[model samples]
Target chain A: MTGFELPVALFLLANLAASLWRVLRGPGDANRLLAALLFGSTGVGILALLAFSQTPAATPLLDVALTLALLAAITAIAFAQRAWQRGTDPKRADD
Target chain B: MTSALAFDLLLAALLLLSAWQAMRTPHLGRALLAFVVFGLLMALAWARLDAPDIALAEAAVGAGLSGVLLFDAWRAIRNKPDSGKNAGDEA
Candidate 1:
């Protein structure tokens, strides 16, 4: 199981790198924000895999992963409530 | 061990890329999103360095709080009626 951890973590990192393209080419603000959401979820998985990969299993990293998950949710809520609108242009704010 | 090194190198590269994108991107909203991505990647770097405490702090304060604060600033700038005209003079 430990042998597979690093590879899986690397795969997730690749997932993150791919998401950056979406962020770069976003024709809409919502598309860019979706990439950020992808970062949050993938980051959690990377953290969890790293936590278990160590020989002694640094369990505190699990707590960090949990915190990241909660914060990701909060960040999404804040984005939806405060920054995003239904039909705003990427270059200009309607309000 | 080589794979571990590879993971760290990739994380470091991504971290630098995100940080650069956050600063160099012309669009304020996309730049802010890049900043959030940088923070998240920074947290992972900290974890890889065997510093869980810093990882936790980076996750909470860097990715979470900073993202919201930057968004608020983006909104304020966007809402300003004469922001574009005064862009050069305001700073």
Candidate 2:
């Protein structure tokens, strides 16, 4: 069972790589931020898989996954409430 | 065994890719977003390297706190027309 975990983790990583294109091709900041949220969740999944894959089972990784989940939530909330403003073009912001 | 190595290789590639995108992107917000992604990936890499403590710290400080700070900076830079214009000119 432990042996199966690594491939599953790899699959999740591939999924992340594919979704990353959306983040990269973003027409807006909000869209890129949404992709970042997806990264946070997918990251949790990968961490959980890695936790179980080890011979003795590295349960501490579960704690890491939990922290990641919490951080991801905080990031989304902060972005929605504080960082992003409506009608603000990030491209224009630099110019 | 081979699969584990494959996972590591892919993670490393992603780490490099995100880091590169973070540095190369012209848009400040996009670069910041890439940086957040890079931090999260770095945490995973730490976990894979058998450093759970480092992974925890990387996730909390690197991704969480740093992301918030960068966003604040982005907002501040956006508000300041002179600096924003100068940054664009330099880029």
lDDT of 2 by residue, A13-35 (tens): 99998888666765766677677
lDDT of 1 by residue, A1-95 (tens): 54899999998888778778666665676776677678778889999999988888999999999999998888877776767754346353331
Model 1 residue runs over 4 Å out of place are A86-95, B84-91
Cα lDDT of model 2 by residue, B1-91, tens digit: 9998899999899889989999988766677778888999999999999999999999999889888887777677766867657433233
CAPRI band of model 2?
Answer: medium
Query: What's the C-alpha lDDT at position B56 in model 1?
Result: 97
As a whole number from 0 to 100, the lDDT of residue B85 in candidate 2 is: 72
Best by lDDT: 2
Worst 10 residues of 1 chain B by lDDT: B82-91
lDDT of 1 at A13: 89
Q: Candidate 1, residues B21-78: lDDT per residue as tens digits?
A: 8888666666777788888889999999999999999999999998988777766665
List the DockQ of the predictions in order. Answer: 0.58, 0.66
Model 1 Cα displacement at B41 (Å)?
A: 0.2
